[model samples]
Target: MTAMPTRGAGERLWIGTFLVLGSLTAFGPLAIDLYLPAMPDLARVLGTSDSLAQLTISTCLVGLAVGQLVAGPLSDRVGRRWPLLIGVILFTITSVLCALSTSIWVLLVLRLLQGLCGAAGVVIARAIVRDMFEGHRTAKAFSHLMLITGVAPIVAPLLGGQILRFTDWRGLFVGLGAISVLILLGCVLVLRETHPPHLRQRGGAAGTFLSLRGLLADPVFRGYLIIGGLQSASLFTYISMSSFVLRQEYGVSPQGFSLVFAVNAVGLVLGSQVNGALVSRFGPERLLTVQLVMMCVAAAGVVGAALADAGLVVLLVPLWIVMVGMGGMGANTTALALIPYGHAAGSASALIGTSQFLVGAAVAPLASLVGTDSRVMGATIALATVLSLVALWRVHHARRTTPAHSEPLTTTT
Candidate 1:
């Protein structure tokens, strides 16, 4: 068998490559989660309504979705390193601009720009992984990436809340700016061009569109994309509603709320680590099937607890289960989706990332519409999980009926 390409010469270089790529992947999560504790303060300080403050988040999501669509094909046409570096530079500049904004409108605009720039890292990081590894190794690399990326949510809110104790909302953006600068330095020092000129897509716009259409037409890609998007919506539903539910309704303090968020994040981290160990044995498809079933059961438990007006423990336990299931399923589905499209990994990664964020953006606002009680949040999650189950079943059925020679390429072996 042919060997997978290595990013550097030794184990140390491999570890460094993973850390840099993982940090790049963490950019979006850090951007979203780090200032969540300050959302109320931001609304008050900027003289904006709660919905408008929340719009900042939704707008950022929109930018993230759109930015990936642009950057993905650009990376395919050009190369990964330049797109990544330029994105990091833009992210740093916009973070500083976001810190300096005097009006909510200004902040919203800057947040959109920040998200746009931040997306280059998120999409390109996945493509870089694809360039360097294939098959089961790709799945394994993603699990490690998840471990690194998962730390953002686990620590960001906690750190942000503590920062709020010493400073205001503006300081949060300043910190984000500083983090971006550090990431930029790391990228400059360590990141190499993974996508080569010989392999790059030619003919620019026409070629890009053709590649995108082909990916969309693939049944396997469609199945994984739908599954990923729906699963992500479940998490975003909780994210959009959790602060209000825990802090406003349940009377938890911001610090306490951060701790609650961290607990669930720990479940995600554990799940990713477990999946990493088990994926080589069971294969990503089998693992994803089991995780989806668990997700449905967990969603049901959440709905039942919410309907009963149960205590926080009942709500949190099921929510943690849902998080764990999502954490395990996300990397597997993404790896499966991109494995067959190695030549267009950037575009494939972009589509997956964009769908996940767009679904998240749409689902997040529904929490407020349905009323931000536990039941509404739980029901939103249940709905997403139900959709995910249907998608999973369709993929399973399609695989069963397809001829062995016609099966999509997977890195299971």
Candidate 2:
């Protein structure tokens, strides 16, 4: 009997895994943003209140949360390939239903299904990364994957905006169905099974929950998780509320708003790419420290801008700076947190995504409370900054208390 080649085999596995999985992960942002431009129009057509119409988005979030639970463990049990294929097929079906929806409630249910479908891509993508790389390499690889996923927000809305010009918001769903089908085909042709069946039998759901408890009990993981969750919430809050903020408060049109949205998203790619280059030399811990501080500075600036009644451009400049740092923090934080766990990648991935979405879902209501101004949005930004900084400290504290012989940083998680 021949044992598998370890080091040489591992890197090759990682490279192949991320290439396909990264595209799947990118679909999450695409699903969320693809029809965003038509939200107002969709609400009017469906004869629903704007708030109720927005429930479609919320439904999707709920679905993603629910689906992650299913996909994470299922991946562990049956391997990654089948569950992902099924998810894509469901995503494709529901997307068609969404395009045909006549009422907000109908769309809501379909949106939930869409979210569940999308969740598989993200949860499995992370699990695959953990399958191959940990420590610095894990963090670095996350950055690269983040780079791949980051493209969705940039291109999706633009594409959606153009489509809305020709057809009703329903057309966006049609396009999504088409995109999902194409993506599914790409994955079928290219994506290999990364979570081999034999590698994960002993550590079933019970084992996964236990591993999760251990990670949760650790302050370093808690801090990183909190920062990750809060930062995600902060961005979701902005995206959710941007239309009202611009149209009502700043007096921008919907078309104009999409451009603004695209511009802000540019910061995502910028921050992510820079983080990729910097993490190797600086390390995630050190890089996060600086990024956290800058995020706070940006938050403080946003608050001051709202208070001082500064122009939108003035406030957004600081925000751009903050997101640039956030791009780096996003990947580094996950890698650092996961680096210690090898046996529970699926559960870990599930927990992290669930936490991020829950926090984001909770924070989304702030848009309603704050009522279309810089006020609540600014508070959300500050909240993310404060939490991320605290998380960095907790991670640092943990490093001091526990020191043990560990695997290669490349295989830490």
Task: Compute the lDDT of residue 107 as modeled in candidate 2.
Answer: 86
Tens digits of per-residue lDDT, candidate 2, 23-93, equal: 78876777888888899999999999999987787788888887887787777777777888898889999
Candidate 2: where is the Cα deviation over 4 Å?
A: 1-19, 44-47, 100-103, 203-205, 244-247, 252-256, 403-413
Q: Model 1: what TM-score?
A: 0.91
The positional error of residue 247 in candidate 1, measured at the CA in angstroms, is 4.2
Model 1's lDDT to the true fold? 0.84
Per-residue accuracy of model 1 over 255-317 as CA lDDT, tens digit each: 798788888888888888899888888888888888888988988898898788888898889
Q: Which pairs of residues collide in model 1?
A: 135-411
> Ten-residue segment with the worst summed lDDT in candidate 2?
404-413
Q: What is the TM-score of each candidate against the true structure?
A: 0.91, 0.88
RMSD of each: 3.2, 3.5
lDDT of 2 at 67: 85
Residue 208, candidate 1: how far off, in angstroms?
A: 0.9
Residue 329 in candidate 1, Cα distance off native in Å: 0.3
